[model samples]
Target: MTDPADMIVPLLREMRAENLEQHEQTRALVRALDKRLGGVEDAQKSYRQALTADTLLSKLVTGEFEERIEALENKVRELEGHK
Candidate 1:
């Protein structure tokens, strides 16, 4: 009594609408993830810069300490030679 073609047309329209909605949702999720990823990358860069500064400061302190030690040793050698 009912036509199969008529039934198929309504079902196809429903499927098309659902597909469009899902595509929009996927696009929104991708945009949110991209924004969050940018923040993470910025934080990583800042951390690397801090590490580099710390390393440089440590090297400068160590160099100063080494120079002071050498000066003390030279003074001790001079005093001993005089005696």
Candidate 2:
């Protein structure tokens, strides 16, 4: 019969190698996840900046349009007074 010690040694070595391989695979997956999350965070920041710019532009347009309407109304009133 073959020695039990010889069989056990090879099995233990294979198990250690498998464990190392699995650890490396897990680390690689974590790195990939970190990169994807970083990209998502950058996109969110860009979207926020765009939203702020749009809000400011909308306010400016509304204020300018209101002022123009008021000026036109005043002109119409003056014309009626002169008639």
Candidate 3:
């Protein structure tokens, strides 16, 4: 009494619907992952800039100390030579 053709049509329709649903879900997941990856990249860039700035600041402080010591030593030598 059952018609094989009729059964086949309904099965095909169900498969099509399931395929479309899965495709949409995959697209949404890709969009979300892309957004999260962008955020992570931005954060990593900021961290690198902070590290570079800290290194430059440390070098400047060290240079300042060396300059001051050299100037002080020159003044002491000049005073001894005058006396």
Candidate 4:
């Protein structure tokens, strides 16, 4: 006759191993998503800064637009922080 406790031990060990493997896989997927999100955020920030600079330059050709551009840029930066 089989010892029931001995039989159960191997089954439990296998289950624990499988659970650990699944947990590791999930952690890896979350890390990858985090990296991609960070890249997207950085790109967005760069684009906004470039746009602000361009607007300021265009206004420069006309004369005395710094105050308005500065205010707009400040608002954009504030919004970016919220994101």
TM-score of each: 0.82, 0.73, 0.79, 0.65
- Positional deviation of 22 in candidate 1, in angstroms? 0.9
Better of 2 and 4 by TM-score: 2
Tens digit per residue, CA lDDT, model 1, 1-83: 98998899899999999999999999999999999999999999999999999999999999999999999999999999999
Better of 2 and 3 by TM-score: 3
Model 1 lDDT, residue 68, Cα: 100
| lDDT (Cα, tens digit) per residue for candidate 4, span 1-83 | 99998899899999999999999999999999999999999999999999999999887865656677888999999999999
Worst 10 residues of 3 by lDDT: 1-10
Better candidate by TM-score, 1 or 3: 1
Candidate 4 clash pair list: none
The prediction achieving the highest TM-score against the true structure is: 1
- lDDT by residue (1-83, candidate 2, tens digit) is 98998899899999999999999999999999999999999999999999999999999999999999999999999999999
Off by over 4 Å in 4: 1-4, 64-83
Q: Which segments of model 2 are wrong by more than 4 Å?
A: 81-83
Q: Candidate 3: deviation at residue 7, Å?
A: 1.7
Please list the C-alpha lDDT of all candidates, in the order they appear. Answer: 0.99, 0.99, 0.98, 0.93
Clash list (residue pairs), candidate 3: none
- After TM-score superposition, the amount by which residue 9's alpha carbon in candidate 3 deviates from its true location, in angstroms, is 2.4
Q: Residue pairs in steric clash, candidate 1?
A: none
